[model samples]
Target: MTVALPSILLVLLFALNLPVAFAIAISALSFFFLADGLPLDIFFQKMVAATESYPLLAVPFFVLAGSLMNAAGITRRLLHLADALVGHLTGALAQACTVLATLLGGLTASSSADAAMLSKLFGPEMLRRGYSAAFAAAITSSAAIITALIPPGIGLIIYGYLADVSVGRLFLAGVVPGLLLAGSLFLTTWWIARRRGYRPTRPHFAGWGEVGRAAKEAVWALLIPVFIILGLRYGIFTTTEAGAITVLITLLIGALVYRELSWAKLPGVLRETVLDTSSVMLLICAASAFGFYLAWERLPPAMASWMVGLTRDPQMLLLLINVLLIVLGTAVEGTAALIILTPIFVPVILQFGIDPVQFGIVLVTNLTIAGITPPVGQMMFISCAVLRVPMEVYTVEILPFLAAMTAVLLLITFLPGLSLWLPDLVMGP
Candidate 1:
């Protein structure tokens, strides 16, 4: 009966539409109080144990760094560069939106943040340029999903910690999949823009001179992943340290390099970072307690046995897991899904010889894709808010983008080599 407390509270909180972090915490608290066999002190112990992790240090640093980058005007410069590069192509504005999102996603870990920033910057312009408001909203929301598959991705970080995989490797594994998704969205945008007759903003290609100028402006912002991977691989720092370094570097770039960081802006950055980090950290703390409860209830073992009984073949198991993840992604927050499912699925995936880092990519991709979906999709809501478009309108317009994303997800799911090769090559074994 004590073991059941966590699950019961989980259901009750979820039904009440409580925040994911609070739900997990409340459930864990219920278990602590209701379980006669278990001591309440264990909950406190587990909470300490959960946060004592060395790798977990990366969470705050990365969040802070991402916030700093946004403040530094890296996102704005990157968007300008992306616009210059893609604005001459077919469906120029639409493709530019995708390109800019991909670039910004690399710098920022939050999809909602990316969506809000991009939509605010480009939404009105898209409408004025003859793109439908719904289409603009759809593109903004869909493009932001790529953020979760890029390095420094919060979703991937949470997944790595939950699944007990190396967060560094997960960061590297995300590279190929992120590019694939970006490319697919680019093509989809082109096709749709052609059909819609969206006009190009630029008349011709920007020469190397212009490209170099743009790259120069964005160079500091672009080196973030390079620094993180190198630092992690060479033992210069752990993932957590890398995240802290990212924040420091981003601040330097914003204040010293870009000359944009001001005293006034500092307060806002701190405030926003505090809010963002608080939300994510709470989720982690709650997940810690809930994870213990899951083990107490023998959920992982039961799930493993059930999965194995359903299908012993690795390919079939992968397929089933992918389908389930995709479905869950639509309804649950990506971070929540990662926390809950990572513990349950890691053992089963390892049993089938699936690469944990590769699976992390697949999992994050599916969840990000779901952000464009209807009903509970946060990205959908953010995009709509930015563009002031109705949900019904954006849903119809976003189908092509969704199809493209699904294709990318399937590719990553079936072809592990695509995700693994880059990590193995760069990180080496």
Candidate 2:
């Protein structure tokens, strides 16, 4: 009754369109008042404690760095580079959109932001080139899922933080899977473009000179991910320190190298960062209180035990988890789901001898896929709105891309080495 009441209230609040943070906070607070001997002060303490962690500082720093990079015109250079590299292919604009999203994934780490940017930048261009608005909106929104699987992904950071796993390893582990996703989306777009006889954006392949110039222009932005990985690997900085360092590097590049970010624009970028950070951190705070309630009731271990009883095999257990996460991802906000569910699932997976790092990648990837799904998909709505496409059209066009994403999810789920190889090679298991 105690658990059911809060769970039901959460669903009701979500249906009522309440903010996820308040829904969680309100539902969680109900537990203290309803349950005997539970003190209200503990709930307040839990929310405060959640934001007090040194590692949690990475959230705001990375969010600010991403905003600064975009405001400084890094995204334009990246788009140009993506076009130079892939703009001659069949469905050239679509291909470039995928590639650009992959690159921006390393920079922005927000799938919705990537989707919104691509929709505005390439959406109309694709339409002008005879591509359907649905196709453009679908690819733009779906490909942004790549951002959540790449290094410095916000989802990866939050999952790592909640699961008590190594954030560095999580970042290292995401590289191959992220690329695989990009490639899958690229191939899917190519197949569709070829079948439909869609014209290429460029009349000819980019010359070496053009490629070199594009690369040179985007080199500073390209180095951000490499710098972060190297910094983490060589003990130059902790994960939190890396976020701070990234902000410093981005500010320098924006002000001096690119010379695009002006003093007047700085305030706007900071405001965007604060807004993004506040939404995310507030969810974290609420989830912390809710998690405390769940812990008090011993729900995590109980759920783990129930799940373990269903299957002893690690593979089967993971498959079940994938199913659950996919459903939850479609319905719940990914960050809230990550914070609330990680506690319950971590113990279950550990008992099956699954690596937390590998599981973290899989978890983040699955939830990110949901960001483009229907009904409540934030990215879906963003793309549809920016492209002025109907939801039904966008949903239909997204089917194949969704299939591709699902395939990648299954591949990562079953192949531990795919997620673990780079991390193990670099960090040593």
Candidate 3:
């Protein structure tokens, strides 16, 4: 009952509406206190140790980079590029929002940040142009999940750190799956646009010349991902170094190249990054203590053994785990779910000889989707509040996009090649 009691209490704390970091911290303390011989001091040690990680440094810097990039007008350039590529299609604005989300995958590496930005940027415009609030919110929020699947995804970095897997491999592995998600959404948007009689923004496609010009203007924005992947693969920088370097580059671009991010804005950006980084670091510290508890109890190995006993079939086991992740993700925030569960699941999957890189894609994708699930999905709340769409209405509207995303998720699940191919090619497996 020692371990089980704390696990139960953690759920109860969550149900009581406590903050996630507090919930995890309280539960770990309870375990340490009630255990027969475990000292309370080690809990504090684990908490501090989690923060000492070099890789964890990537979190704060990436948050700062994303915020400054947005302020620098990088997002605006990419949005224009998104428009050039798809603005002539049926449901043109909706299609462009999905495309922008893909581009944002590199820039923000954050689903919540992307969701909030997309909602504020496109929510009003889509509504003003005759799109239903439900449709606007659904499309924008669903597309935001794609951002977390792409390279430089903050979630992937966290997963890689927690699981002891290579972050660079995870980053490269995400490219194909992220694009596949965009393609699925594009098809879904086309069907919805045609059915609703939503018209295009432009009468005809932007010619190659227009697309070329848009790409030219957005070239600086586009190079960020290429730089990150190449730097990591080539051993030019560690993940932490890559994040710091990117932040410096983005600040210079914002201040000098675009001249959009003014000197007066530096303090505000730092303040925002501190707030974002604090929440993430706090969660990491708390979750790490609880993680120590799991290790002490040997829970992950026991769980892995139990599953392996149930079905030696790797495919069946993965399907079951994905369902659990979806259900768990609906309650916990994506990063929290990832931090708490990665230690448990990674060991389980590795038993089947599964590549952690492929599973990382599936795991992060499921959790991001949960970020959009009702009735308390973080992204869903961000989008609905901004667009003024009710949860019940959004629950209905997001169904089709959710299905499309699930299809893409399953493809990544069953076809390991989809996730592994790029990483193996680029990084030599």
Candidate 4:
């Protein structure tokens, strides 16, 4: 009976078009009552436990920080700086969209938010520049996914909490793979631009004077992620406190430094932050109870034992896990997948001597790619809406980018050092 809960609950909730959070909670409650012999009160208890953590506070603060940065004009400035740097490249504006998305993602950590923002800011520019609407939508959506792997990423936060890994380390672990994905996507854009005769964004490179000016304007925007990582590394703050500090820093930049984030705009930012944070936290709380059901059934151990019987080799195990995540990602939200699946897989991977940090990067990277895949891809839908591109057109245009991202994912998976070396070098054993 316990063994049937994960699948049965999934089908039931999915059939009803329930929100993912409620689906998780209802399924978990069903299991608690039917098979686990647990009290109904455990559901509320787990909710309290899920919300009680200090680190969990980061969710709202970071969500708010991302909002504040947008309000403060940081996002606009970052776009200017990115355009100045890459705007001379072939397909320059498209590439700038990617770069700017990556930069703002560092602050926002939510791919959906990043994609929505880019759609508004860069979506029109791409259309004006003669890039096909479909291509622009595809690139914007795909580019925003780079944020999901960067430090302060909400996906990493969920993975950290569910798997009991250090949120800070997971944050650090994401840096290289995130940048690699960005570079690979850029190259793909260049190739497509050259083949399609996309015009260069600028006739001549901006001078040092312009570059310096853009960078100066964007400085405050750039330091938020760096401050979070350093604070966590030095024990100046936990991930939770760092989030509060992120809000403080963003307010200062928006209110004091930029002066663009006016008092009148405060309510809108707060409203959006609450909506986003509530959606995410509700999922976490629900996932916690669902996770408890899995534990109660002893599913992880059973699955781990079965997997070991199939293959004791670490690489084979990783390949299987990656394949599973890709399929799961198409149907499930990335955070939901990470919370539900990481526990089941991570222990199995560790048993085969795989580095948890390396696996974490590979895991998140695969899910990042999933965000752009079809049939319920949240980012894909967001991009299509923003650029007003038809699904079939954008899907075809996005293939090359997907292939490039896949290559990077495989590289990180096999070359464990790429993901782990920096973390080890900077953070030590």
Candidate 5:
């Protein structure tokens, strides 16, 4: 009754449109009060302890770095480079948007931020070029999914912290899969554009000199991710330190090199960072309390045993897990889902001899796809709001991109090498 009551309260609260963090925290508190002899003091301890993590510091640093990059005009430079590189392809603007998302994925970790930025940056132009609002929204929302798989990804950092996996290795492990997803999205965009006869943004291929010029302009912004990977691989810094270093570097580039991030802009960037960090940390605190309840009740082991009995084969187990994640993802916010479910799923996957790193990528990717899906998809809502497109229109247009991403997810799930190859080569197992 103790377990069922809390779970039911969580669902009921969610249905009533309460904030996720509050819902989780309230439900968890109920567990303490309802459970016979369970102490309430432990709840306070868990919530406080959850916010005291060093590794978790990466979230705010990375988020602030991204905000600084925006203030510094780094994103504009990268978009120009993406345009010079892929602006002649079919659905040229769409292709460049996807490329831009892939590149920014390294710099920024938030999918919704990427979607909102891209929608504003390219959504109007795509519409002016005769592209449907639905198509524009679909492409922008779906392309942002790439951000979740790329290095310095907030999702990867959180998963690494929660699952006891290596953040540096998870960063390296994401490279191939991230690029592969970009390629898949690129092809899907091209095929759809070709079929619909959507005109390319550029009349001709950009000259090499033009591409070179754009690259030169964006070189400092481009080097951010390169420096992060090298720094982590060579032991120059720990993951938390990497985030701090990234912010320092971005501030330098913005203030000194780009000359766009002014002293006046610094306060706003810090304010935004505080807000983003607070929201994430609060959710983490709430989830920690709920996770504590689950641990106290010994739910993970029971769930793991049940899963093992249901499927002894690793492949089948992975497939089943993916389906559940996708469904849950469609309903829950990705970060909330990650925090609440990782404890439950990690134990089961380990019993099947699954690599936690690979599972982390698969888990992050599946939830990312859900962010663009229907009903409760945050990315979908952001894109639709930006483009002024209806929900039904956005849902229909996102299907192909969704399928393409799903294909990549299945490939990563079945072929562990895709996720592990870079990590093994760079850091070893």
Candidate 6:
């Protein structure tokens, strides 16, 4: 009952509209305050101690790196690359949005950031192309989920940090799953375009000259993942050091090569980075205290046993967990839920002999889809607000894309090799 107190308080606090970090902090501190043997100071200590992790430094560096790259006009170059690659396809502008999200995934690794940027960039263009406001909003928002699966994604970093998995391996493992998502969305868009009689943005495919020109301009942004992965695989840098290096690389490209990000832009980027980093750091700290309470109650292994008892089949267990996460996602924000759930579920998966690396991909991808889902999806609201689309219309238009997303989700869930092969091959098992 005492252990359950925090869980109950957590749900109640969320229901009462408390902010996520504070809710978690209060719930966790209450457990320490109420329990006879537990020291209340330990709760405070855990919050401070969580920030001391060496791996956690990746969060801010990557955040700053992403901000600097954006200010440097990488998004425009990526948009051009997307256009050259897919602008001849049916529903080409919409298709470019999908491809751009994939390319931006490599650059930003942020679903929300991509969704907002794409919506503003493509929303007006799609409107001019005679596309429905809702369809435009749906594609932009749903495609952004791919960012969470790509290397250097903030979600991947947090999951890897909390799950005690290699961020490097996680980075490699994510590629195939991310591609699966992009391919599925591509096929789904093509099918929908054919039915709607939508035409490609470009009348014909880009010639080699056009392709080469665009890729050349965007080569620096494209090299980011390659640099990070190779650096990690060859022992060139630790994950934290990789982030620091990434910041340096982007700074040079932004300031010197692109010449888009200027000195005056530095303060704005720093401010945004500080705000973004603070929110993620605060969540991690609060989750640390709450996590300590869970450990004291011995909940993870207990829940792991209970869940395994419900079914010994690992595949079936994954399906069940996927359902639970999807339902939970509509209510809580993905990042907060991810922090809260990773500790509880990591033990459960290990008991089934499932790879933590694979689970990290699944967990982050699943929660990322939440940001596009209804009832409380942040991306949904952002896209809708920017495009001025109605929620009801956006909800309906998002279904087909959601189906495509779910298809890829199930594929990666069942096919461990899909998520595991690259990491195992490149970084070794």
Best by lDDT: 5
Deviating ranges (above 4 Å) for candidate 3: none
| Candidate 6 lDDT by residue in tens digits, 165-239 | 889999999999999999989998899888997788888999889989999999999999899999999999998
Q: For model 5, how does the per-residue alpha-carbon lDDT over 195-217 read when each residue is reduced to its tens digit?
A: 98888778899989999999999
Q: After superposition, how far is residue 338 of candidate 4 from its true place, in Å?
A: 1.1
Candidate 2, residue 228: CA error in Å?
Answer: 0.4
- Candidate 2 yields a Cα-based lDDT of 0.89
Q: For each candidate, what TM-score against the reference?
A: 0.95, 0.98, 0.98, 0.96, 0.98, 0.97
Q: Among all windows of ten consecutive residues in candidate 3, which has the lowest summed lDDT?
A: 327-336
Error of 1 at 260 (Å): 1.2
Whole-model lDDT, model 4:
0.85
The residue ranges of model 2 lying beyond 4 angstroms of the native Cα positions read none
List, in order, the clash count of every candidate structure. 1, 0, 0, 0, 0, 0
Question: Each candidate's lDDT (Cα)?
Answer: 0.83, 0.89, 0.91, 0.85, 0.91, 0.90
Q: Of 2 and 4, which scores higher on TM-score?
A: 2
Output the TM-score of candidate 2.
0.98
Q: Where is model 1 more than 4 Å wrong at Cα?
A: 1-12, 44-49
In angstroms, the error of model 1 at 198 is 1.1
* Candidate 5 lDDT for residue 321: 94
Candidate 2, residue 162: lDDT: 90
What TM-score does prediction 6 earn? 0.97
- Residue 17 alpha-carbon offset, candidate 3, angstroms: 2.4
lDDT of 3: 0.91
